[model samples]
Target: MDFPTMGDLADKWLEVHARVPNGFMKGRPFTQSDWQFWCTANFYRVRVGAEFVHPDDATDENPVLLNQAFVYRRAQVVAPQKTGKGPWTAAIVALEAVGPSVFAGWAEGGEVYRCSDFGCPCGWGEKSHRVPAFVYQDGEPMGMRHPSPLIQLTANSEEQVKNVYRPLSAMIRQGPLSELLLIREGFIRIVGESGDDEADRIDVVSSSARSRLGNPISFAVQDESGTYTTTNKMVEVAETQRRSAAGMGGRSLETTNAWNPVENSTAQRTFEAKSDDVFKFFRQPPAHLSYKNKRERRQIHEHVYKGSPWVDLNSIEAEAAELMQSDAAQAERFFGNRLVAGDGQWMDMPKWATKAAKRDLPFGAKVCLGFDGSDNDDFTGIRLETLDYYQFTPTYGAANRRTLWEPKAWGGRIPKDEVRAAVEEICAKYNVVRAYLDPQFWETEIDEWASKYGDKVFVKWPTNRITSMWASLERFQGDVYDKDARFRHDDDDQVKIHVANAVIRARGLDPATEKRRYFLGKLTDHQKFDYAMSSVLAHEAVCDAIAGGALEEEPDEYVYF
Candidate 1:
């Protein structure tokens, strides 16, 4: 109806720049006449990952038709380094500046956007043929109408503007759209006639950003957003832009490098944002891309970098290998496209998922419990491990699948009554051998559990003893990979999420040797891994029990007395 659909607009966009040879194409002039021959943007059309896809195309099975206008208000794309982030962003901005990006009204059947030059018989042909352009119906902006729009570009510094704004200006200055933009002092003015005007300008918002809170921004681009943390106030600036846009039904986009988790960057927050309005595109390395296997890692390197084919694989590989020697985490984050947790993430997500065991565990089964208590900020975890049971399967997807060790439970807050009831239920249903509780904010709950089930099961395993926790974590890592001593859990999102979020940090010296040791932690304060921590202590409980002595099944020598 509106034009063709969003796909057609994308098709038109690719066609329009079809002859605009990228620098990679021998730095040559437009030698080919066909739009496809001149540009590299269409490659995305052939193989677009979710991040690059149009918002209307939400699902592969049923992509939404983009006939009319429905520009998403906010889009946050967090990708690893060296992807075509800059090029694609530049292209999108240019299109919005002066292209058929907005919705015109619905078209009946075969409609075309006729060019105004009647003497020349000019027309928006082929790619945009039979597509609708914005037209007046009731003295309104038919489909997409911004007579004079202002777009702002903000980053950490003026220098950072080069990341997006420089390329953006260049694309308009050199590409077919050059005629429309007049390079002005403070803005690039887009107009039909050759003159600067307030109606349409793309401005680079200042770094201080104190006075930018209430500007009328039709579109805003926050570049290098990974650096926009709470302390920097860049995120607040972006939020202000979003608010400003909302008043005019405008929108904003954030282009960021893969953010550091501990930084709590706006990029990180956007990735974690769980709202329908906030669209996100975060393409990271698959967790299975492990450094342990060289060939696999190389193959995955090629795969993850598909979004940016211009990168020199040979150079990236060499640099990554060298970086791995000193900083594997950095290499992983920058090139491998993996989000690293300060070089101390406990386990790889794909590797952990490989250990998922789709099995059944019911009431009355013997299990060891690990409890991590939280009152408000954090969550409470009640983890159960198999009662030292194993099935020797030498050949499975994951070497030695933990047939019985399954992560079974979790709760949002420390629901005192519910937790007490859960502990009571656990104790009554199973032969609870060891229930290790960390008594932090949950002193009352831990004490109550000890009183109720202490005699039947082991109680609070002091986490303050840094030495013991260090040992427990060490054992747990070993168990994760020992194929013969594999760790596992059910396919519950909570368990998977907690496991993926788990981080390890070297903290507190061993009381005896005065040597620092690693303990479980979250990369960011907002990240949750208390559930996984509970599992660690629970697994540790079993380890300690097995180390001491197996619980002997009390002899059923019941003499009728």
Candidate 2:
């Protein structure tokens, strides 16, 4: 770990000048939490007596710039919503505006920093007003105010920028920060030595304004980067700010809540970036606890909300429970601090997880099987639903059970012989009441199976029919979310992964019913949802069996294989 960070000076400066922007402590001195202090310390970690130089510009002779002076060129902070990120961002902006924000040199000894020396009267030697002295120990690194700092507080919209700008305005107006800076509507100007001149300024920028984006900046704070996606054009804005900051040898700070992985947002890209000079801070909850379990969810809340003492666990629980009713993934992402696909997600993972059960049906139990087939470029799988409503795939037979087959695993083509053998083995192992086969690329196999197993047993079930497909999906979803329904499935991870990859795609309104219908679609071409579709077909088969009086009949005698 690196030592002698200028964050010590920053911490003291915020405490002396900054104030709480709102709530009960509105006008009190601002205090950094332990987590905030850690962020400040790491972001300000500097190479002693060194200057920043771009790797492209470094030659064998550039003395100060040759060394990787600054440990990090940029940094990102990921935390839960309302964890004081806005106020922390404001404090950072304040520090960059007038505090010791740049590298000066090494401290020899006995060098003290007093406000009086910096054209201010807030010092011990002053007649009524006084401030504490920051003594520089021997061999310690020193910091100085930027010569002409320019900072931008930016987001996707003006309202989003207020997340940072509003707190900053209040901080300056409610505390001693006012003496050093003047806060207007969208600008905070630092007073220069002449009292009337502007030394530096902080501007509020959004996606709507791009004129002043090219100006050289000392620092920038990008708030809510999770929403900075290419669709909103905030991705371009973030890239522009990085270039602007780099021009002046400055850096940026990105603060955001957890992001949806499918959106490919700026925060997601930043986290996935492999650059060593980018510092990332993300504290996820313990993996052992399942977010679907209500008891474990409270524990997860406690873990992720550790540093934020002001957060109320009971209040968070209420809000999360309510939000889970509509958007389970969002609740987990916001309160559980977990990255989950929220937008356009077809299935609520927590609801699906709640339906997970261990396979308990006896051997040779009457069951319905759903089959979806493909030759290549996709997956082929079978799902089983017992007469008692417990769903599972046969994992105990020979030949790897052959229940789930992926073309990629087998020379880019599904082995028809292996699939035939597996289907026969399943027929011999269980008293199959009904089998719904998609019969798209396997028409010949379906015709042969219908002859051998009876046409009523192996029926053609085409998934391309949007109307029936949508109805089946709706029924499965309702069963999963309805408390009164007893729908359950085997704890299969492949099924869960496929379900998570599924997204909703709406087709036009039905001609007869005049109601909009939707079906499951993959988030991307490579992310397969075949297993999830198979599960839905399996549930639909079970419903048909009950309606046709198959499950109502007496069970067949058990036969040992």
Candidate 1 lDDT by residue in tens digits, 180-246: 6667875687764233455787778755644656877667778888888778777788778878877
Error of 1 at 157 (Å): 2.0
- Please provide TM-scores, in order, for all candidate models, with all chains considered together: 0.70, 0.61
Q: Give the TM-score (vs. native) of candidate 1.
A: 0.70
Give candidate 2 misplaced runs (Cα > 4 Å): 48-68, 124-131, 194-199, 343-561
Off by over 4 Å in 1: 1-5, 17-73, 103-122, 126-148, 192-197, 291-297, 321-327, 343-368, 377-379, 384-434, 447-458, 490-518, 521-529, 541-561
Structure candidate 1, residue pairs in collision:
1-107, 18-35, 18-38, 19-38, 103-143, 103-144, 148-199
| C-alpha local distance difference test of each model | 0.60, 0.81
Best TM-score among the predictions, by candidate number:
1
Clashes of each: 7, 0
